[model samples]
Target: MTFLPPDPPNQSPAQRKRKKKKRKFPSQSGFWTMMKRKKAVEEPARVCGPSNKVELDPDLRFGLEKAKRQLESLRQDLTQFRDRLISARGSLDRITTEESETLEGVEVVIMRKEQDILGLEFDIHWATDYAAGSRAN
Candidate 1:
């Protein structure tokens, strides 16, 4: 057997020119073109049904209104309690002021009663409770 390779076939000039033209003008089969055509033909529809609408029951509405009224009343009560507490605290502070009276070369320290101070502290505690209850409601 001969070890030489066979001679290749010679293509005509017309066939070579056609092949060159095909190479120059490549096929228009890109993925984006196909995707654009598909999107142009078929688009997804976005729609909501009647079930999405909100429906509030009459009892719930009434309850909400009642709760709102209660909240308003609680706020007013809390405000009144706070004002009373502040006034009481101010009066107690005034009573606690040191008053020095020199009677016959003897210094006298006149301390006020502790009952008003205790009463003011109690009012402050009650005001805090009123505020907490209002927030909880």
Candidate 2:
């Protein structure tokens, strides 16, 4: 089934389109104004004279002195540490030398025991041979 509806009112065409103009920035105008103001002001001419001197604060100067003293103390401590380390290394080297000698002594004792055991075995063998010869005779 089809349903019929009443016709809607016709609308008029839109007006001619106008090209959008680019926006003028306020920063350029401000810059030009600042430039004109700077031109109007006269800059002071430089005179040849002694440069401005800055005085150090007394507290800052005292703090710097204290820091220098602390730095010197730290350096001395580092030097002492290095010296002690060298002394300790020397002692360690001596200990190692003594330990090596002690090890050599232990090795010599082990070798001597081995030789004694071999000698006893040889003596026992000779005694057995002598007894066997005496019995055969």
Best by lDDT: 2
What's the distance in Å from true for residue 89, model 1?
Answer: 3.1
Query: Ten-residue segment with the worst summed lDDT in candidate 1?
Result: 104-113
TM-score, candidate 2, is 0.30
Candidate 2 Cα misplacement greater than 4 A, ranges: 1-95
**Which candidate leads in TM-score?**
2
The lDDT per prediction is 0.44, 0.49
The regions of model 1 sitting more than 4 angstroms off are 1-51, 91-137
Candidate 1 on 24-73: residue-level lDDT in tens?
43555676787785544222211134333223334444654565565556
lDDT of 1 at 75: 53
lDDT of 2 by residue, 7-96 (tens): 335522222112334557848988999877543321211112243222333544465456556555655665565456457767535545
Clashing pairs in 1: none
* RMSD (Å) per prediction: 26.4, 42.0
C-alpha positional error of residue 80 in candidate 1 after TM-score superposition, expressed in Å: 0.9
Instruction: State every prediction's TM-score relative to the real structure.
Output: 0.28, 0.30
- Give per-residue lDDT, candidate 1, residue 68: 55
